[model samples]
Target: MIKLIATFCLLALFDFTNADIQADRLYELLKTKKSRNSPVSNTWSVSDEATNEYSPVYIASQDGLSELDKIVTLPGQPSGVDFNQYSGYVTVNPNAGRALFYYFVESPTDSSTKPLVLWLNGGPGCSSMIGAMAELGPFRINSDGKSLFKNDYAWSNVANMLFLESPAGVGFSYSNTTSDYDRSGDKNTADDAYIFILNWLERFPQYKTRDFYITGESYAGHYVPQLAYTILLNNKKTNQTVVNLKGIAIGNAWIDDETSQEGMYDYWWTHAVNSDATHAAILKYCDFANETSSEMCYKVTDKAWDEMGDIDIYNLYAPICLNTGLKNASGTGSINVFDPCWQYILETYLNDTVVQKALHVKPTSWDLCSGDTDARVPITASRYSINTLNLPIETAWRPWYLNKEVGGYLEAYKGLLLITVRGAGHTVPSYQPQRALTLFSSFLGGVLPPPS
Candidate 1:
């Protein structure tokens, strides 16, 4: 979804947030007759999901991302579409008082029995547009982040890919209630996604029976499993239409904050990013070093949490990644725009036209930094973004995203094989395509080319 974060997003501070402006300029998005009520506000339209035409789904290869797919649009949608032959919808979120942009990827030539993959971006409010065109989708964009690029390793090659701008307040989707944005809890996000899928299937009835999978990264670690659980719960009730779901997967997932941070510190020491002396110092003073001042038995997780909390091993999100051989000199360099983790490889991937064309979003400014609310807030001056907290909060994706098993090797999870890049900070697809492909092959079925 964020594949377009850097490429686009010049003016996010638009009146899109103002209820008065929307009521005066466009259709009154805020209505009195609705259930998921929050304070009333007018909603925007689907066209607002993205600032431009570049969207999700991409095709990537050794030649990088290529751009040559049929331009298919959906019916029952608004006008001015590139292709009116396909199926799409403009989902107005009644709760948040806004509209979001969303679309589906039907089989290129056939609509036979197929699997569905929903690719989402993190940031809680980020757009999954790039997820459609760039990451694991069918095509990529040009250098301008506006045109199209075809991806050879697109996930659509194996299963149907669906992208969404969720939570009513994010992207081009809208809800009338401002309170909708305020209550963006795990349960709400999961429920909204479930509803979107149900409505989406209704819009494109052919995909109703497709075996579906939930896949994403970052905070989506929380999303995939949470949503899957909701589906599982719904499957238990009668008269409820069950969403045919397989398994769940996430990459570079911020599953359990406690373990992730501990893993990061260990990773830094082992990778030589920090000196043994400083590494020991962090461990000694560990931010979360103690439990009940030494004589209390907390939840077993607190032990791990305390250790990671004590050490600022994250270096303020600046772990150096040199395995790819791209170096960041002193001062701003390469992907060092914000954090220095995985700087080398991320910079290299952004330069590939194949990647660009495959994703279909041509970023005006390419950087290694996570949009991470960087454009809106002063992250440079602040210590950390909500992302840092979003990562550590204990959630459901924990057991699997850790890539290990405690009670058993795991459940009968037939979801996609998901893996997090060892050194990547954010967006593993952008930082570590090779590992992403390897895991993709392991979980799914394919021969992903090693990154060039």
Candidate 2:
């Protein structure tokens, strides 16, 4: 019984009245989850055979023309920023009039030396701009809902960060063919994102040979691996390193359907969010591996939801915004802390005409994660998925620290690294920015977190 927030973009859309209906829709989607049938592997090795030739779609000369997409400055951005910012559309399918919108930020100090990390935020329908604006991006929206402040822990400090609003219907990306929207799924998303990256590299040719990594959270658990696989296959097919992909990482990911569902219920029970009887009933009646469940299973799951009450299940201990209607007021917490009402403030800022013009997006309504922290995708789900892999542990779990304070725990597997933020929720960066940044830096550096 996984309850979802309907759409992660609901907050961006500034619509809350039909949240329950959206949650129901998400639950149904989860119930009918389709198996991608893609193989799961602990290590993904790219082809060793190489060629000097580039993809037929890539043209080095197009690099100079990318200035057309350069962003001068955001509407309310702080001054003294040194990094270059760019945002615009890249046409992935000209015939279908399909284009994906992206925002690119170079590292402030070493634009040429740093690796390029492409980030996707999962909604399957949500925009990645949420990552850019609310999570690991370079700036944070101020409480005033009209200005921005620098995020000291922004990921751009160590890597050239690219955030994409993917698929045809999400965010500013679009396809003129209305039927294209109906065709959205895992395969289509991976294919379109692949094409988007190919075309994007042509625009920024300097990064063509840069070490590239894919990262995301939530449903991106699916998107990141799928896209990485696509990149590998295409590279092997062409015998060329079309995209110099290195690795991928997902946080609080929803990787496997059966394990994720089972783990969700288990997490709820262990966390004392549900009654003992409801947990027992679920364990007795639910068949998570099957496409359908017993009627008793549904009844118990619904009961579990009722027992949980109105808490932010994402970060169970975090406060819920008592005043979601304060669209213009400044939020209560600082940039490093989670502000329950920050989404409302961000909605007002992004919806501003000036901001839209600056970002080069049309005046369409923006959306945020309405169901981002839903019970459907939890940290426990990720843990279960990892267990299914059963990779050999290279390093046993140990506490990781930052500045003499315990930040999280880390464990290294034969081909995977598992790290946990002590108090983070579904969106790790939002709840623990500094710790999240340290994790990201360590991931890029291929080193363990400080054990002290």
Candidate 3:
């Protein structure tokens, strides 16, 4: 039954019977292929100076409450925009000299009435700025990779969006304490994020009592819920209206390793991304249920990766960016077009020194994806529940309706709701913006995704 469902999801992937032995060679090449930014050197320089002269900041009001750290205006901001945007940093831990950067966009209208939504992108180390500029924010990277265009369906249309680059080392957020990056974990991350929010509220007192929500994708499956739990815990401990965290929504989230691993291998197999022999080998040698693998399993997995070819595995059916000469080339894909080359464009635009200076970011290479993937296993291994806080394999799956049709599946264990976006990859809004917005709107309304 699971195979059938995966087959339906991946009918367009590949045909296993047509696979050839050359796949082994492809797999071998993958093993040694280094990233363009391989051997990333530590960019942190020794500073005997106590103050960072490069840090750009703004404080609009008195009492030290209303301030925008590193406030910046984007280089190519679109013309005649009604919404207000502030990009800067907020120091969460002064002793550690740890500060997290953020991009906040007020709703297009009714800034005071709309809820505040915090968007996080997970690498356990990736920047949330990607989520803001590339995925669901009000502005998108232009084809030239140096300009911007407005995203019509930006989440800011419905809510005040807050995009954060967290945990001391992701993007512009940094710590004077070097070990903070090495010591970063889900618990510390959640604790810091909670503290950051409290400090952020002190800066923007208007939203002190407004409705708030947490939303993110990928490893944020751990980041979002854990932070939400912290907010809940603190709320109860204080018996006050501090956070106003109402709900959480995650897209294409990694809930559990065992289930995700099973789903991934299943996805690859049914999509014909791997040959039947390779699939069988995986089943025999790899234990997805226990998160264990044998030597033979590793070999088979390599073959599978080899067969995956030069396509974006995240969106299997999506096109690959084979052209490296993209500087002058208006990429074949754009925000609405869902072009696969968006990543390249984003990397180019964010790393620009001018853009960096505008955002008050020190000169350092910005990586789209970073951090140790291992930090996440500890997070998923523990049980988390909306009610009891235990992570369970079998959730209460129900069909959520949107536009009177089945939009996706929704499962609620106690008060926690997990909604799976239909036909979406790791990033739901990027692949299915309309559906994602529907889910977002419904989730904020305290209802299921549209039941069409």
Candidate 4:
């Protein structure tokens, strides 16, 4: 249904948030209307009745993650690299035979003192390995699609990075019962991730008390916040420090559909991507304030996309991968601009049997973008509304500086934080690695990026 709606608006060419935005935006408005007449829980919990009927679907168990911990040796890892890398599955639900695949990279130096950071990618079904191998991880896929190179600005340099392929049917993560995939949603995703983290900590007790943070992009605007909310709820329930959660930082976050979509159209107009007439039409016809827009809104949106052409919405200025056939092209340094073909090359590399074996990835085909291909875990917009609305206080928006220049803007609410990578698109780190690293290091240190 969400995908069907994207067809009406030119498929997010004008709005990077895509169909999930409308789904969430509409759901929130409806939920708010409903909440006016009834009560809703601040923290979501599985009822005994629901659990008793469905819980038995879990059919397996694991006591520790130690045995699952593994050392990875990529085909062309840079020589003399000092960090330890692990990739394997951590059973989140043994009875249901549910497990989440993970890739962990310790800091190259001082692994003990650095904070632990979990990174998720939002297709709601996308693999964080995309973040690991192509974005901020220690190693990047060579253009040849068969080797690796070091990422100097990798977030792992400042914190231990852990990436997961979650909700089953994503990347290599799987469940024995096919029904589990069909039942996946925001709440279950968060619930399972919370358990995954807890079980993961038990496996690596050394970092049981380490400061933790969650970060991701795109739909992760939903994932990161929901997971953080879940952790906070558990913390209150136990009245004790659970996972030592510090804060979360999301890049180009899609927190609220209405605001972000409005901003996107406004962005197109201001950036000259939309014609003056079209921009005015959008402004006049679109009612993002109420979630769903009018038919005229859809018409103008289509016109906006027609003018934008086949550009990468993720980075309006970034080049598109025109030479995908040349997967073996020589790699280049991480520059202000990204390698347009990186995604193509990454897919080729990750789908290789040799690469999959090395990473302990289940023998399944891999793609750079999931694009909600898995029906089991539909993008649940209500999760965003639920988490964001249930928060005890509103987030305070402010500027964060680095080296005397505005690094980016930020919003903080209790234990959660939202960040924008200045001039970056959907994937912040890819287009602005330095700015991303600055944002990341600051968040981990519990300080704003230093003033320019």
Candidate 5:
């Protein structure tokens, strides 16, 4: 069951096959949307608001030149954008020639005063650019596939956002030592990411003491926590607060192997994706903690998958993009008007030579996840993982609101909080941007979401 679920979810989310399909679909969509005479405007501007009053303590810093990585502009970016953006490689292991890529976006209004957030997208091998471009980054690719539009709910609007492509093999990050790629795993990935952070701070010294938070989704469940642990261990050994590690927020993450698997099947069963007979077989024949299963367990799960049919498991109710290039035909009754083919648009835009050169990236093909929703690391998996911690509840689970509508439910544990985004799949922000932003704001503010 474990192996099956991981293979199904991870491959569906990160496999190159889906990326190719999405890219082709994007071209078809663009052909229909682009106009010859009145071209889409590339220039966009957001009015500035007053400087944010919630400021963190600042420490005096020595100047470090980061001009080499500063992005003058991105291809087709809106003119008059207020914030500074930088992207480049940070060498984590010089001896091995292992380097990781990063894209940093400063807060638009009060960058110096805002906290720093590091965002990772987890495949254990997936690139963080997915988070930057598709989820909560400052820009969204236009249908023309060569222009950009602003993401109004960009996390950078309130925090200085840092996106990383880690472990020296994902995205633009690379290692001259070929064996490093094969050896990359959780421990090494976490260590290299920590080194990347240290080296990155040297390049951008002003942020060394900034209040920092880590966030990610899916396999990042492992990346975020492991990296945070490394940071904490180093700080404890040095007896000094090195990174100013503040907090971490993981959305629909896959943290534990056992609970996540159990939760996933439970979720499928409870949500009516699997038959009761299959659920019974799983419970009777599968041993999640032991990491063993009978042949019957496999048979039952295969049956479950077949019964689930062609629906997007990530968002149970979202429309599925068909091979025929159809739109809105799945009829899943989703809450958000999610573009089933958005990944193709992103891949088309990012793979453009002009866009790569402007971002200072080497020419390489970009791939996307299979679907936009969150079933890969389902919410039920998160719930089960949290339950095992056995922490005392500080607040009862209750519905949280956005614009007077129920967004999701959240429960505050002694040292943690678990919040869900209603109608969100594996990727919360992509499915419900406004609600994700609301949850993010509440997290950074160290408060609960509005319960009223």
Candidate 6:
């Protein structure tokens, strides 16, 4: 029986069929590789100085568009834009502990010292690669959810852009031990993300001192800040302060649940997305809490719809993939459940295959809308009910996600820049990557820009 298991494991480890051989390593079982893990896999012990020093980061300019374009090997159509793509893996806990799928697109400019940023999406289970292919990445998959297209305003132009598919269970990133996959939470996810960076440093070694920034949205407001705080704490303790850790930026973040839900419903009324009758009723009777509803309230879908009354603009709650047919009929197959937004990514993305090749990922098509994906996951109920008004930002964690500890799941971190793009809903990048780009650059530079 042991022999049978050993042989099966070896086959899984050796079956490397992919564009980049590096990616195959992620699937390789530690048992078969039998090799030691990345060097910086050690845990943090209370120490004054870091036990290790990362290699110096070599800065590059945002020039050489031609070179970067080639690196991605994206196709071009006169009507379509040219973009780049690459996919692989990074080891977070090298003791064969944790791993994350890595994706990047060389900036359009030839500059070697371009800035580096890691972008993540929320859902705790959603993959950021959707950012690479659907929203910020140079390419967008066709509506078929299988083909590829070009994205003209890819973020790589401004920085050495990268996206990750993390926490196992989501995307091609898998775990050797199901134990890791079985459990999911903020702390573990952040720790694993930190380890992934350490391993990423081991692999690239060159970008150690590079100005590194972390960014995300929605539930990621939590994922992004928490991860940044971990890096900040670890850097101070381990002496591996090489992470430029410049600044964290989040767009339309779910900062505080009370405010988020309030803003959500108010947003519906202010924008004429919700019925006046529903809005007034919510304001008068619904506590957003004891709303006299049987089902759980707050962000949970079913009850939220029954309570909010088509706040999504003649739409119920976030729609399931069932309405994908609507996208096709309306020529809207550009986005998917994988991404919350980016349907517009299709308008210009499909024309250029160069962006597709640069991303090194081939999907039958891309799902830009998060609404569709929400249908599949196990629906959740918020700890507190959604707020009835757009409240103020009080703490780090949203009321729904907060647990009495860690400040009700709200963490307070210094040096984070918050951005809210007007006229944008849900995922900002998919809806407004350009606006997101402006906010991102300002955050990295440690400055706030005037809102549009």
lDDT of every model, 2 decimals: 0.41, 0.73, 0.63, 0.64, 0.69, 0.46
Candidate 1 local lDDT, 52-86, one digit each (tens): 33222111121210112223321112233321122
Model 4 C-alpha lDDT per residue in residues 226-263, reported as the tens digit of each score: 88877766665653336787767654455566655565
TM-score to true structure, per model: 0.53, 0.87, 0.77, 0.78, 0.82, 0.59
Worst window of 10 by summed lDDT in candidate 6: 3-12
Q: Which stretches of candidate 5 lie over 4 Å from their true place?
A: 1-65, 239-241, 323-336, 369-373
Tell me which of candidates 1 and 3 scores higher on TM-score.
3
The per-residue C-alpha lDDT of model 2 at residue 381 equals: 66
Best by TM-score: 2
Q: What tens digits encode model 2's per-residue C-alpha lDDT throughout 1-452? A: 11110111001011111222223434555744532343222222334313344454332234555798888889878889899999988887777888888999999998899999999987657778878887899988876778888888999999999999877788788888887887777777887888889878888889989989899877787788888877876786764337888878787776767887887788778877888889999999988887667778778888987888877766666677787665454543367665677667777887898888888877777766422453546656666777888888888978889999988777777768877777676667877788889888888887788999
Please give, for residues 1-452, the per-residue lDDT of candidate 3 as tens digits. Answer: 00000000111222111111112222232232222333323321224222323221222222453444434468877777887777777787777889888889999899999999999986557788878887798878766787787777789988999999977898888899998887776677887888788778767888889888888865676688778776766665653346877767665455555655555666666666678988888888877554244667677877876776665555555555665445565433355576456667788888999998887667888876545111111111212212235645344667766667666666554445555555554455766666677767766676555444
Error of 6 at 420 (Å): 3.5
Candidate with best lDDT? 2
Q: Quick one: ranking by lDDT, best first? A: 2, 5, 4, 3, 6, 1
> Which lDDT value does model 1 have at 426?
39
Winner by lDDT between candidate 5 and candidate 2: 2
lDDT per residue for candidate 5 within 158-210, as digits (tens), equals: 89999998767787888889888877667787778887787788788788898
- Lowest lDDT 10-residue stretch of candidate 1: 1-10
Q: How would you encode candidate 6's per-residue C-alpha lDDT over 429-448 as one tens digit per residue?
A: 55445555554555555444
lDDT accuracy of residue 156 in candidate 5 = 94
